[model samples]
Target chain A: MKKILIGIIVVLLLAGCSGGEQVQSKPQDQGYVFNYNGIPIVVNTDVEPVLKELGEPLDYFEAESCAFQGLDKTYYYSGFELTTYPKDNTDYISSVYFMDDSVSTAEGIYIGSSVDDVLEAYGEDYTGGENAYIYTKGDSSLIIITENDEVISITYQALVEGLN
Target chain B: MKKILINITCIVLAVLFLAFLQKLFMPKYMSSIYEGNLIEEYYDSDKDHDVIFIGDCEVFSNVSPIVLWEKYGITSYIRGSAQQLVWQSYYLFEETLKYEKPDVVVFNVLAMKYNEPQKEAYNRLTLDGMKLSKSKIDAIRASMLEEESLITYLFPILRYHSRWSELTWEDFRYLFNKRKVSHNGYLMRSDTKPVTVVPEGRKLPDYSFGENAWYYLDKMTKLARENGIELMLIKSPSIYPYWYEEWDEQIAQYAKENDLLYVNFLPLADQMNIDYSKDTYDGGLHMNLAGAEKFTAYLGKILKENYNLEDRRGDTKLAAVWQDKVEFYEWMKQDQAMEMEKYGYLKSYGAAAQAIIN
Candidate 1:
């Protein structure tokens, strides 16, 4: 009777361990929702949020160094292109881009969409030339480029000065 | 007599051993880190170039000197490396002028974006292979990152000493010499990774090139002008870095003020017959062989018509030299194609698995 009781308890513990694994399963990519501080790294957010999320970048180029790359301060992160600006003693993200497709926007803008898909997703509030499409919403904008009718790159930028 | 003989023998052997060690310790740039080999290869050249290009990889990977020579009879070389800074170019031009006086010196405008020193790794790629001189010394001083030291640049053994354990057969085989890694200064990629995505340039808070960068451009312009060398500034047609209007305006203004010719090729992609989807090797960051040939052919016409460059194909000595280069170029083209087919990535050419993955 004692042996039978012990085996029953062992089976119960094994069942309990696996039952927890199934509930804890989550998506492999969490949609690249990187936050710097608590600002969510969205448009109109300051640079502090980036430091909050990623802490200090591994390397940085000053404004003079970055002027050649057409950036102010190009911050190197793990698989992220983050640029920031300083105005009135405050730092804020000027632009953010990803070379990979794992990251996406809430509106579903991604690396391989068509020119028409962009207009449909973001509405017609866009201005473009032969090679570019700039979709503006308030002070935030999504710059998309389409080559051969396929969206090749997408970037997010805030259209405000670093400091007021 | 015996003591004197032994001492002399010891001195000779020690010099030879140090020479061997120096060769081993230097970057092979053969299997991997191809950019590292680029600047050093110029030393092996006959140094008989008519036009010498100095800039970043955009100039090296985009333009073909063999094609220029074959089609235009213009002997040219590109002294380009990865992320070559403005001061680095200024210094490289200074170094190149010491060897041969090329009538035309081309500066790729892409490097104008960088005014200050970039990464130490990139600095080493551009500066290390250079034969030690005042130019090399200046380049080291201007390009060194804060953590880098001049001593290491002077004696590369100290910088690369850690690589002792990671040495491979390439080091042993090329101890005395190196394989001709470039045709003139062009690193070839016969394979294609089409531009699937055209990235838009983000608006910058400030679009002007930095004052220090302008300082180098002024120095370059002044140097070229003083030397009576015609300087042509070109913006190659790699689409991903996204050449901006603001930057273009500034470059154009600078060109006009200096009475220099500046060609922004991004707008002329249509005229060049450049199909980004088919032409680029690394998704528009660089051009493959087909793209490079087309760009070179078009630019050669401009060089012939506008720059009044001589076509030297009829010169027997030059022809003999070029024929050898053409043979090597064909062999590399075939080799790269075979490697691509066999490995799906450039395995033999040292393309890391990450090369295709990204």
Candidate 2:
């Protein structure tokens, strides 16, 4: 009776020990679901989640995330993939940055009304240090800045006529 | 005393239950089981295998163990892992010593993998395989769960016990329905078009004989030599030849200093009669089934002529098994060709399984 009682107690104790959140599968084991700023979104992969959560990416590539072959596809964030497409087809998200875990914004030019207007929009928070040069390559704005506080000259190049 | 008995009983029951559950739930025959045995079996068989291929996807996608086994009667097996490293090779050989021993061990070094960021957990998991026989409790403890073994064992739902929720109907049926393991074991696609990798001006890092990698290599060499086994370092064909050449120089220097045999096959792809554009399933890093067949056959001839290995085919106990496996391979080959045609290079599960046998 005592042995049986012990067995029952043991089983119950084992059972009691159970029940906790399963260790989230490794990042490469399956698709990912992420909450970006309280918005839940499912990204097909780690890379996708990172890109979606962070914003625009700098550069990325697909790779196996582990030493084993069983891992699902993972993306290597090399920065971001940013391009200014024509105004017709795609919505412009502007310059994007990509990372292994997430993507984020990088400091640079803005697209809209005028150069000084863009500077005022970013305000003093913009780290345009000494010798900072802002220019426009056609419709795209260009800005180059250095370490010490300096505002370099800004230039606006003309947009090519009938450019796609 | 009662409490002690209870703890002991719990551990034993937990272990047995875990074992039973693992057997019941796990895929009946996994690729690891086959790969684990394939190397030992070839080594044990009376027939001398022509070449022993090693490395990761670079080897499996490019070299067919079965083709080598069948064509040249070379009892070859691919001891490659997914993204194999020089360290894992050490453990594999360590484990392999328990059963059969091979004549030659080939090391297919990858170029991009030299500076890989290591994974501590995965390493611990693989290292656990080395400690399975001390006791059942020890075995459970030594598994991939590591510190989580107790929790996972008792609850199971902790790891795969509740895995039912994690899988789909397709996965459930496919896993439960399989009684036999059929596979070619190659996952990556073979490419033919040559790609270039020009490192932005970095001289090859000195891969001298004193580092951890060199220590493992030295140990492996000494182990093989002590066992009267030959060691060959072969570079699998790759699209990026520059990286291969760079590593090849380092490996060759190591070989020259250590008195080991080294062969560079990256630049020999065309010389081996591999059709660049079509024979490759990918653009070039790996080989397709067709490419693997050619490469394995060539490798087999090399082992036979150079190594003076004896092809002990008809007399080995594994002959019957090999014959059946070959028959399965033929079926899989036909199925794969059709599937590839239909799926257009994106192979299905069945095609993937068939690929291993091929």
Candidate 3:
């Protein structure tokens, strides 16, 4: 009877622990990092240091998060756009969207690059969608959207951790 | 025999106690985040409706059932919740069919963009109000995030036990009863925050709807067809979270192939007289009560023309019930207006009140 009671209590404790919200750990060494000028910006990491390093943005916008507290902010640069999601009163990089072909990914893949070029650079080990190919490394994903054999959009996104 | 009887009684009492605790611990969405209460409000309504609108915040905040009734005498209900996924909407529709069948089922296509389970808070907002059933079970299974467990949903006490420390009077007062937060599932916002600039949709990596989203949509279509209901797909005219042309084309193509009526109302905002400067409540994410009335007036006409629906105003019993709804609607509208007048913002509605309090 004592053993059975102890087992039940242990199970309940484990269940309680398992049910807790899972906070995604910040990527340390892995994940794709975009090099803007001399600064390197990584997704799922604190955006403050990167923003300070990158200087003033061309444009900025923020909206109260839908059905959640805090704000979703966007900063537009010359060739790319950086978006951040607020958590614990601090902003974390959510995504980096390439706007023009003037800038390329850290991997040398740019807009107007061929699908073959992407395969050559990033390799064939990617999840292929109808028009987009997603290459994931650790917590970050490099998505290249193609149309007519030419890449139209390239974006690096952090895998959303439950709530943003 | 006596020992067995005592043990049985104790077991029954223990079960009852846990159930009571579950009820008490549940978040009573009386003051804030009223969207959580929208789902259960459907149970109180007279279930005989000509149309059912199901989706996320887009349907609940954009469409007005009161306006539909007043203009065309068309009875309708919107079963919408915050960030409602496609599978959640499908199960909700399946559950709604168990109560009553509407002639037309309108599903907002915005939720199709999301392929996976979103925030757990959003899942709770949509699912907690739903009564325990096979549909709710299926919905919970389909909607649970990576961290969420089935047992937690089954026994809400397990999920909300920690909420004991945070329990307010609202929780205790609404332990057995919930306040009516929506009018036929429409969450009314009388205040306006006009659109300044409609942000362009960021270039998405994939424009194609996920296979999971398509699967549920196909299921929804089949379910509607089996019930002899016309499924109308709509893109509500909220300008933000920008609805892409590519997404629109795919839905349009699917609708064309399936012989369904697909309407993208964004471009027709001018015809609908939806002035973003006045119509939108939160920039461009959702429409205010004024906007919903205008949209509903336009939609009511189309629904009347296309669908085989009778203006149930002639039905004395239904009319009587709707009369009460109209009265309540008017009272709430006036009350909200009064609150706005006094506070310069709604004091009892949404995060505004919490902001003021803080």
TM-score of each: 0.69, 0.58, 0.90
Position B199, candidate 1: lDDT: 36
Per prediction, fnat is 0.00, 0.04, 0.23
Tens digits of per-residue lDDT for model 2, B78-192 = 6554444565665566555555677777777662244322332232233322334233233234232222444444343334444434444434554434333323333323323
Evaluated on CA atoms against the true complex, candidate 3 attains a DockQ of 0.29
Tens-digit per-residue lDDT, B231-275, candidate 3: 999999888788999999999999999999999999999999999
Worst 10 residues of 1 chain B by lDDT: B349-358
Candidate 2's C-alpha lDDT? 0.46
Off by over 4 Å in 3: A1-14, A23-30, A53-56, A113-121, A162-164, B351-358
Identify the candidate with maximal DockQ. Answer: 3
lDDT tens digits by residue: candidate 1, B48-144? 8889999987888899999999898999999988778899899999999889889899899987777677555567678888999999999899887
Q: For each candidate in turn, give its C-alpha RMSD to the true structure in angstroms.
A: 16.6, 12.2, 3.4
Q: What is the interface RMSD of each candidate, in Å?
A: 22.5, 14.2, 5.4
Q: Where does model 2 exceed 4 Å of error? A: A1-164, B1-15, B23-51, B111-117, B120-164, B168-210, B240-244, B313-320, B350-358
Q: Write the number of the candidate with greater TM-score, choosing between 1 and 3.
A: 3
Comparing only chain B with the true structure, the TM-scores of all models are 0.93, 0.71, 0.97
Q: lDDT (CA) for every model shown?
A: 0.73, 0.46, 0.84
Highest TM-score: which candidate?
3
